[model samples]
Target: MTVASLEYNGKPVVAEELTPEAFKKFGYVISPKDQAPKIPEGTYGMAYRLSDASIPVNNYGNSEFKTEAPCAFNLQRFKPPKALDRENKVYNLPNVERHPYTTQTFFPMGVDAEKAAYLVVVCENDENKLPDLSTLRVFVARGNQSVTYGAAVWHGGTCSLIDQLDMTMFMYDNGVKADEVHLVETSGLRIEYHL
Candidate 1:
């Protein structure tokens, strides 16, 4: 329906550093920084293992969507939020969405890790499969980091802070009703970030 119809606990969220352990239950923080090298120091020595946790899941089974292209690898661009309060480094969240049948991933392209960042707001589902505001969490992700939203996880609109972010995105879709969006009526839901 409309954002005015949703319920939100009126409190702003201060974003914290994203880490694998902290984000494990929701999804993951994908990055190459601060990890021991996993490959032998020879041919593929440059490879530092990040994660293999992004395997797609079809909770509703794969037979629901009938289409030629079930998955898409796309190059996309995201600008700073229209609702961003740059001087205050805050972004007002209007809504959240979820892909109930597949995971979503974004890889930042040519982003300067030191200069720009983005906000990722997530919450767990309630017994009725609605956004549980009490469990909401916000994370500040650097340009060096990427993220994969686990299947059926609820997340606020992706907002790039400071500068535009170009990315490669991957997701499964047949252009149907499996993608869900909940309009948030919570007036104070926001992300407070550090510039």
Candidate 2:
């Protein structure tokens, strides 16, 4: 058995609308729509949402991420699996990971709002500090959105749908051990969806 379980109960997990209210536990939804009605003016009127994101790292528990870790920016390319691109409807959740010391953000680039999409699969930690399967939740994030995985939260991989997607990700890192913790589960994670 893996560190978690899923509800493949025949009907898929319907990647419904994502809301910051419901998603606060895992992280936050960072889209223009989620921004306050009035964009706060800064030193320059052009600056946008500069102070909106959660602090890059949590400085609690004597965490080194604050003083020793450098905020790393990376570009990621993701595509649907060969077996389940635009033709198929089901996706398997093969793995999950957590960045214990820092919050991670993903911003899709040049994606068409109508055609590109991805799933956000996340869950809370169990009493034993592992991913709690019963709490798993999946949200559909489209081209206009960005997601931030809170520090120490467990979440799935890219899981994009339809066409290929490119993303810019930001996170704090030490380049070893504190980078990420992963769980690779081979079965029992069939996610059904329709493009």
Maximum-TM-score candidate: 1
What tens-digit string does per-residue lDDT give for candidate 2 at 5-87? 43433434445566677688788787666664665655555655447655566433355434466677899998876535446
In terms of lDDT, model 1 sits at 0.72
TM-scores vs. true structure, each candidate: 0.83, 0.78
lDDT of 2 at 32: 64
* RMSD to the hidden true structure, all candidates: 3.1, 4.4
Candidate 1: regions farther than 4 A off: 1-4, 36-47, 50-53, 60-69, 178-186
> lDDT of all predictions, in order shown?
0.72, 0.69
Q: 149, model 2: CA deviation in Å?
A: 0.2
lDDT of 1 by residue, 77-143 (tens): 8888788898888887877877776778888888886545778888998898877887888887778
lDDT of 2: 0.69
Model 2: colliding residue pairs: none
